[model samples]
Target chain A: MGETPPRSANAGTGGIRVAPGHGQPAGASARVAEAPVSTRTPGGGDLGGGGGLPRARAFGAERAFRGLTLAAGTAVLVIIAAIAVFLIAKAVPALRANTANFWTYEGWSPNDTAPEFGIGTLAFGTVLSSALALLIAVPVALGIALYLSHYAPRRLGTALGFLIDLLAAVPSVVFGLWGRDIFVNPVRDFSVWLNTYFGWIPIFGGDGPFGKSIMLGSLVLAIMVLPIITSLSREVFLQTPTANEEAALALGATRWEMIRTAVLPYGRPGIIAAVMLGLGRALGETIALAMTLGITFGISFNLIENGGNTIAANIANAFGEANDTGRGALIASGLVLFTITLIVNITARAIIYRRREFTESAA
Target chain B: MAKRVDASNVTAYYGAFKAIENINLTVEPKTVTALIGPSGCGKSTFLRSINRMHEVLPGARVEGDLTIDGQNIYDRDVDVTAVRRMIGMVFQRPNPFPTMSIYENVVAGLRLNGVRKKSILDEAAENSLRSANLWDEVKGRLGKPGAGLSGGQQQRLCIARTIAVEPQVVLMDEPCSALDPISTLAIEDLMFQLKDKFTIIIVTHNMQQAARVSDRTAFFSIEKTGDPGRLIEYDNTQKIFSNPSHKKTEDYITGRFG
Candidate 1:
């Protein structure tokens, strides 16, 4: 990105000489040399030697600031590497000790003599619940973000944005308790209504009690993740350049049309990153899902049935009554969750980076 | 295709602040009129009010009357979008929708007007690019993003996008300010050709640009810092530069004070 400006400057100079029938190539070359001087001044030693004492002091401060920021950035990578190494070391022993097929086994009985357990149902439930939660949350979040960014009045938008930001600060345990107590009944009624109308569909075909089902757990997770997605998306939408928006409007676009053309296209990668962040949050939310979902061992797609379990919830629920093997098994499940989150984050970053050239050029 | 623009006692405000007051001007069809003023003198604001683009900002609005070809644009029953369709704008900084392809950017206005036929879009894109003098440069790379182009090319792409809809009037707010001298020259040359089809109103900080491109010129100035900007003089470009009626206009034209 830094190299582009100098290259373009050189190109501009070359184009000028060729097009204008000018014979002074030396002057053009000198102009090109001058273009990059300001960019190079910070690192140049001549400024400090020839200039006043204050110039040397400012250069020292700049070097110290750069060094401090570089150290802080490297520290983050070191900490992340340390965590990954620790999780893998704990997870390896448990996998080797397992008697049954760790990949396909349907149940967890790691405390048994031959200690058998697998992540099949737990991983499935984790992915399904989180994916469902994101499916429910993202569209609604985008709607609210657009409303706040474009349609709502300024004061109302700011107030609503602040309230949504406050929602993100609420503890997960509070959400869990609220979901368990207050939100469960309404979700169960909705699930029953869905089942009555759409029972032929496998996911809604279940007839048993529906209060502590995947539907309920996912609804709770969706609500928990909603604020993060909405806030991030709102920020992205608001950051759509005024010039671009005016360009759309001047081209005869209505307000919504302006947003469709200028704001949404600009915010696509950002909104994707925001949704992936929400998915990550939903995937690892232990207490909320544990409290809302029925902690069953079997895998089923019947969302209205009281039978679902996730990896994080399993760890939280099973950690209390576990022996050494059970504890190891729980850590192994955690490692899988970490891996899933890592993949989610990496994919999101890749999507954003793919459009970096366009976005950076605009800036 | 061009339509005359008439502004009568037009005043603009941003919240409680009066930006421009009691400005009156008439822009003839198929003619290029330049609004030349110092920075902060509200030339851009007055230019924006002609197409009702100023009101897009919160608490920014215009009063009195602005009309196109005898139809009052700011009437209570007027559709703002339709008004904008008849009048397009090119901003100071080139702003082609960064995510769109060059082809998409050229057809963006047409898409808004619901012209979805591929053949029609292809024809319009080629014509508009040719009009903006950018077709040969960008014809092979139409699928590439608009932001991938050089700054001058991006500005021309914006011009192509604006002209693709065939607006009757084109408003440019300091279009050449962000461009290099060569690119500025290219745009100035384009303006001369464009005036044969569209009424052009350009707000420029460069006196030479006004002298070079505009058929008529309006000079704007403020008496003091907090005072609203007023139109000091309006006349033929040659007359304004050589023999202005107002002392302020002469002072400004001679670079004595802005």
Candidate 2:
């Protein structure tokens, strides 16, 4: 090839200067000066001053930050594993010492010389109460969430949303006290009314003693978890994309139709997650359920009868007076509660993953 | 079915702030009309007003008359949903319902209108997709999520969804602004094919697109920021591009000023 003029000089002469203050000063100018040598030589490291630029650090603060986050994430799994190990280690010895069958026996007398205790009553009551609570709470929570996100004016929605969040911040112990001291009155009268008119229904068949029953405990549980589901569902509903909502509106959808088409579908997975979280809270709830549920030993479907018990509530009520074997028995029950919650969470994740295509695409 | 659109002395506002004022334009049936303007010039606001979608936003409202085929759409007794059904809109971004399948997105309007027969929905889905020039690419994937499509395909899917209900008028607001050049050409071609069945109104920032696809062009501009936008010139595309009467229109078309 014939001798070629320098490329930067030729390029500088060809184009108009668009950016003001165009030329580089000092070291940057020197770097630009060596560009043509590298191109012309077509060899590595041919340009002068090319190696003068400082190499980036072999390790940076980002590595430390990443390690910190990784450790934080792993710490959660480690703690969970530790809890499982402790529960199992504590529980096996008690199960061996127990005179009664752990799963099927209804009575709990673990402190006795021939300790006879089982999770049958506690398991039945826990499932029945939490399920009933969700049945009552989910619809009401969804209704409140939709009202807050869609029907309320901007200022009203924000105010109401703040109030709902504050509702969530109230301690569960306060709910327990209110359920026992104050709220039980109306529930007793309502239970009497139910027993009077609807006594034919098995659940309401019980007479006279109606206060502090499964009905009361479930009602208290519903109120306790209501704010959790409502706030989370409202947030999810509010996050429905404006583009999706507008697309529905522009397609001739009525207000309800718009919500059904866009808001509800887009918020489905999030709402499911919210409901599952609420269910988890209701399942593991201790003090409030302990105070409200009448502590009885048998499994019964009579909701208005003064009889119900749950694993967490039993644990709380019996923990103070428990012996070593008694404590181990309680730990075993706690293990059962832990397993139930794990199964519930895993089921929720499976449901979410089943619709992974839609959720992922939406994200 | 095609319908003529008439807007007279229309003013739209966001709360107290007017976005567009005194927008007077006539769009003939079975023709393509383009609204061209700079950003913040209320071209989108005017297009949204045609279908009452402008007022969907909080504190937004519209005043004055908008008629489709000589019937005022904003009358007190008129159902808003009916007005929207008659005048369908395709948004700037392609928004196929994220949770819906391709077939469901196309038939979403029909389902809203209470059409429930399986055979009817299937036929309508196919026809609408074909009209939007997307049937061949998507027929096999009707069960797939509508959001899984490419950007260009999604826009086309949105077009199909809009037209499936067979609105008399279709409003497009910068439909090709988010697409690549090849995709833009596909949409422009689709717009041409669509003009035979529906009255089309499009808002665009691309001057050449307006010149190429529209029979008539309307130029909108604002005096300054925070001021309401006004119509500068409304004329035949050829005349407006070649010899605009207004100085502002000429300057805008010739790249002198926006």
Best candidate (score: DockQ)? 1
User: What is the lDDT of every predicted structure here?
Assistant: 0.91, 0.92
True contacts kept of 2: 0.82
Each candidate's DockQ: 0.50, 0.47
Once fitted onto the true fold, the runs of candidate 2 whose alpha carbons sit more than 4 angstroms away are A1-78
Return the TM-score for candidate 1, rounded to 2 decimals.
0.87
Q: Compared with the true structure, what per-residue lDDT tens digits does model 2 show for residues A1-363? A: 022347766677665342221332233346547765322223222334553433322444456878999999999999989988999999999999999899999999999999999998998999999999999999999999999999989889899989888988889999999999999999999999999999999999976588899999999999989999999999999999999999999999998999999999999999999999999999999999999999999989999988899999999999999999999999999989988888999999999899999987897
lDDT score, residue B18, model 1? 99
Candidate 1: tens digits of C-alpha lDDT, residues A1-363: 358789999999998556423422343345346775433234343332564321222333447878999999999999999988887787788888999988889899998889999899999999999999999999999999999999999899999999999999999999889988998889888888988999999989977888899988998899889999999999999999998999999999999999999999999988998998899899989998999899998889999989899999999999999988788898988988888899989988988898887776666
Model 1 reaches an interface RMSD of 1.8
Worst 10 residues of 1 chain B by lDDT: B143-152
Kept native contacts, as fractions per model, are 0.85, 0.82
In candidate 2 the C-alpha lDDT for residue A58 amounts to: 44
Off by over 4 Å in 1: A1-86
